[model samples]
Target: MRLGTRGPHNPSYVWRSLQSTKELIKKGARKRIGSGCQTKIWGDPWLPDQVNPCIESVCSQGLESSTVSSLRSAVDGSWDIDIIQDLFSERDQRLILSIPLSRQECDDNWMWANERFGVYSVKSGYNLQTNVSDTSPNSPSINWKFVWRLGIPAKVRNFIWRVLSSCLPTMQAFLTLRVEVNNCCPICHNLPEDDFHALVSCPWARSVWNISSIGSYFNSSCTFADWWINITHRRNQNDVELATAILWCLWQNRNDVVWNGKCKSATAIFDSAQTLYSQWKMTRKLHSPQINTEQQTMQERWIKPPE
Candidate 1:
């Protein structure tokens, strides 16, 4: 999990660290071809521990987190000639290397290549070039894992999209609209469709928030984006998690109206989310006595190695 070391290519180390569990990794690769685990090891640049180091390089290069992670996982094992050749095939090798794209271009290249060649086949080709194909014989990375590992891990981003997609009535229903027609605010019926209105500005959404104790903590007319940004950037993990839970409950109420044709109740949603958040925090306190202690210990463990 540390930075790369000088030694034989230890595919096992990368696989074990990224996966962090033997059984999960085994199940993941059970039916895949080639050394499936090796593909994952080669794709990801920053091992679990390599995040900060790799982040430094990406920041220096002005690459976004999602893009950098994707690219890193793409070319990390390219030095393995067998894998490279298989990925390129005899024809592709001649074509791709002949017109070697820049890093940014490579990103698009790999996207298309993965679709056409499949992650497994490309990794197999690379491994074959290095004579390491099926050497260890284990697992392969799926598109979902690649998306998660290579994309932003910011829970807030995921929460935002989830809430928007779930709460927005237009997207939830099967009502067909004109090609030029736009999805607009359901309450105000003016502005473009977005979570901000559904969760923040719409009269109904505001009424729901106002009935809850949480509404008293912020300005009456604040936007959803503002509320989310403030809560996420604050130094409180519990608060962030609580806010997310609240959003989920609010979204669920919206779904009920769409699915069951039932009237929405803001009070019920607020009470449920609040109760859930309180119970979650209480359970965590009871079960995880070491949570606070580990936070302090982690703070103390951070040390700069000698330059």
Candidate 2:
């Protein structure tokens, strides 16, 4: 449905509710150009850029109602370079030229911009909604490329991101959100619960780290992001994986203490992390393609027997 269309004078509750979601749909949906006949050059979200798909260049006086097809050559059905250069800004011209035109005749289509497959899924929608709403000023400057590239489970990586972003449901975070709750650390009961305190400075967390392999490598950074950067930079990949697993398990233990009133000892937590990391490595090894060592050995020995 068109977002700009007006509803009935006395719209039903369901109709109004559905209308409210149009803005969300608008945020995630974009026109996939094919024939480019029906798509508006200025208004439609047809550009290939991920950050801002719609064209940003100011429309010329008479070009307000121009369709994407107007910018194309009628003879070859390709973009008219001279017209494009004259009508759009340099950035817009580059983006417009980059979008490949389909050789065969096809209708323009709509696709979800958030997903690689151009199809909408509830998970992607939920992530988009959360990302849009997460405009907290206290959000930390995290190395998102490093975070996403961690050789760990997706859930663990997501947890690490939430922690670094200050989006975790720690007591201090709740206080920042104006959520009235005890701001004291559940594990320590001394300091305010925050990303750094809960994950790094807590007595229990410190104990867990002290007993772990990467404890000596820990750097004294004031913030969680800085701390993580230091650790990731200094440690090897295997050490980082172990450390991440431990952190994940440590967080899980903290969560259990918060929700279930159950707490495991620091040694138990460390052991759990070791177990988790070992299991994950084993699973990866199992799934990876195997080489026929015997066949390679025989081939190596077969020194071209005189045919």
Candidate 3:
């Protein structure tokens, strides 16, 4: 939604947005107790868990109207363990007991339990919208780190990330956005243009990968994301470098066909990839003596803004 004059909000849009927010809060949110007046003791997230900040209680036996303060010390602002044990199960009681109560006198607040500090922020709000489960070791960002850690240039890794996220100006992406563009592959026109077709399935893309270091590891029929993850996460350093370079070259070749009417052979694509791979490797060797192999990196990562 576009920002308007900072006066009144559109009622209909605001209501719909709040409804969606309520749904997310139900899934995760931690209520940090203060005065405990604003939160429902049994309803809102008042308990803490490691993976999730807030836990929900379904035992709505009789305490619908009670506030969290009803279970804590009104004089010293501490949680009463007996009260919690009486109302909740042993598991919940332990979880609720672990939360360190605040000492300063203030109003009760809804904190984003998923974050480091309990305070809410836009980044935390955006994170709540993702479907990717961090519980998996094979999660997208985790594998993406492997790609980024490869000796390739940061820009190429960034481009690959964009490609995986489907942010490239692929023909199918335009068509999906109702941009009135043809969906056929811009390079080959053999299949509908998408990340997979443009980078892997097209006749030219297949030719490039056939002779590269990643030769025959993936076929044209493999899904782009699955193949990408398999390469970056599973393959060795040399193969990872070759795969990244080939995909980058393929994308550039696609652009050439789209804008410059220049189509390169598979051999030419392979040469381009190899040249880039060598250059990046040599550059890294010349500049950095020791490699920084930490999961966190100095390389800038792209994150989509909040919708």
* Ranking of all predicted structures according to lDDT, beginning with the best and ending with the worst: 2, 3, 1
TM value for model 2 = 0.54
Residue 43 lDDT, candidate 2, scale 0-100 = 86
Where does model 3 exceed 4 Å of error? 1-29, 52-56, 59-66, 73-77, 80-83, 110-145, 164-169, 172-181, 219-221, 229-236, 259-261, 285-307
Q: Who wins the lDDT comparison?
A: 2
lDDT of 2 by residue, 222-274 (tens): 67766777788788988888988988898899999999999999999999999
**Residues forming the 10-long window of minimal summed lDDT in candidate 3:** 1-10
- For candidate 3, the TM-score is 0.67
lDDT at 191, model 1: 61
Report residue 102 deviation for candidate 2 (angstroms): 7.5
Q: After TM-score superposition, what is the CA distance of residue 8 in candidate 2 from its true location, in Å?
A: 18
In model 3, pairs of residues that clash are none
Off by over 4 Å in 1: 1-158, 161-193, 216-226, 233-236, 286-307
- lDDT of each residue in 1-307, candidate 1, tens digit only: 3223333454444553454333222222211112223223223322222111111221322323233222223455223445445433354334323332233322221111222332435454333322321233432211223223322225533655554323234531212322234466444566655566556666666777677544523465554545654555552555555556666676666556556866456677777867877776676567664646656766445678999
TM-scores for candidates 1 onward, in order:
0.37, 0.54, 0.67
